[model samples]
Target: MLTIIGLLSTTFGVSVASALMPLISVELFAVGLVLKAPHIPWWALAIVIATGQIGGKLLHYYAARGSIRLPRFMQRKKAAERKGRVREWLDAFRANCRKRPAWTGVVMLVSALASLPPFAAVAIIAGWAKVPVTTFLVTGFVGRFVRFGALAIAPGIVSTWV
Candidate 1:
C-alpha cells in the first residue's frame, strides 16, 4: 500500500511537470512507468496522471484569461498585441466561440487526445476564449483519461504478442 501511494504521488508530480513544461514528455514517462511497474493498474495510473495534467493546465487557462498575472519577464509586450492576422483570427475565434460555446469544448477534447493543436496551446486558448470551467474540466478529463489509459496499457498488449 505504501508503494502504491508513493508511485501514485510520483506519477502525479511528473504528469503536472509535463503539462507545465512541454519539453518533458509524459507519454514516454507513462510507457516506461508501466513497463517498470506492471502491477500498477492502467486505470489508476490514468486517473492520477489525468488529474495532475488538468490541475497544471488550469494555471495556464487562468493566466490566459487574465485571472492570473504572470511575472514581468514572462508577460507579453504591448507591441506583440499589435493588430495582425493572428490577432484578428483570435478575435474572430473568440467571437465564434461565444456564439457556439460547444465548439470550444470540442476543440479542447480533440486537442487533449490527438494533440494536433498542442494541448498546452489549447489550454491557453480555451482560457482566453473564456471557456467555462465545467466544460474544460469535463472534456479535458475525459480525453486525457482515454489517452493515458491506452498508453498505460500498450506495454501489456505488446508483451502478449511478443
Candidate 2:
C-alpha cells in the first residue's frame, strides 16, 4: 500500500514536471523498473504509473485549454504576423480533426504510445483542439501503461537472457 502510494506520487510528480521540463516521464518509467525488481509487480506498477501519468496530463491539458482562451495582445508587426501564422496552422489542424477524426485519433494513439512528438505536446494539442476528455484519458492511459509495462519488464527479460 505504501509502495503504491509512493509510486503514484512519484509518477504523478514526474509526469507533471515533464509537462514543463520534458523527458522526465521516460525516466520515471525507468525508475519503475528499479522499483519493480524488489517490491511491486510489474503489471501493478504499470497501472499505477499510467494512472498517475494520465492524472498529471489532465492538468497540462486543462492548463493549455485555459491558456488557449486567453486574449492575445500583439503590439509588434512581427508578433502579429506570427499570430496569423499560428491561427492558420490551428485552423488547418482543426479542419483535419473534423474531416478525418479516425486519422486524428490514430495519430493521437500512436503518438501517445510511442512518445513521438512528445506526450506533453500531444496533450497540449489535444487541449487546443478541444478533444473529448474521455478520448484523452483512455488513449493516454493505454499508451502510458504499455510503455511503462515494457520498461518494468525489461530488466527481468535481460537478466533471464544473460
Candidate 3:
C-alpha cells in the first residue's frame, strides 16, 4: 500500500513537472526506473506515468486556451502584430487539419512519441488553434504512453543485453 502511494505521488509530481518543462519527463522516467526496479512492472509504471503526464498536459492546454482568450485590444502593438502572424499560421494549420485530419493526427502522434518539436509547444499551439479537446487528449495520451513505456522498459532491455 505504501509503495503504491509513493509510486502514485512520484508519477503525479513528475508528470506535472514535465508538463511545465519538457526535459524533466525523461529525467524522471530514468529516476523512476532506478527507484522502482524489481519491485514494479514496467508496463504498470509506464501507464501510471503516462496518465499523470496527460493530466499535467491537460492543465497546460487549458492554460494556453485561457491565455489566448484575452481581449485583443489589451495587447501592445508589437504583441498584436505577433498575434496576427500566429493567427495567420494557425489558420493555415486549421485548414490542413480540416482537410486531412488523419494526416494531422499521424503528425501529432509521431511528434508526441518522439518528443519532436517539444510537447509543450505543440500543446500550446493546439490549444490556441482550438484543436478539439478529445483529439488532443487521445493523441497526446497515445504518444506519451508509447514514449514513457519505452523509457520504462529500456533499462531492463539493456541489462539483458549486457
Report the number of the highest-TM-score candidate. Answer: 1
State the weakest 10-residue window (summed lDDT) of model 2: 70-79
Model 2: per-residue Cα lDDT over 1-162, one tens digit each: 456567656655665566456646545555654656446677876777677678777877776666434335522233256666777887788788778867767777877788896787898888767787787888888888888788778777887899
Summarize candidate 3's per-residue lDDT along 61-160 as a digit string, tens digits. 7766665344577433443556667668767886777788777677668767987877777787676566778888899889988887787777778878
Candidate No. with top lDDT: 1
- Scored by lDDT, model 1 comes in at 0.90
Clashing pairs in 1: none
lDDT of 1 by residue, 1-162 (tens): 349779989999999999999889889999988988899999999999999999999999999888999999877656365678978887788899888977778988999887878889999988988889898899899999999999999999999999
Ranking by TM-score: 1, 3, 2
Local distance difference test, each candidate? 0.90, 0.71, 0.71
- 2 or 3: which has the higher TM-score? 3
Residue 72 local lDDT, model 3: 79
- What local lDDT does model 2 show for residue 82? 61
* Model 3: how far residue 94 lies from native, Å: 2.4
Tell me each candidate's TM-score. Answer: 0.91, 0.76, 0.79
What's the CA error at residue 10 for candidate 1, in Å?
0.2
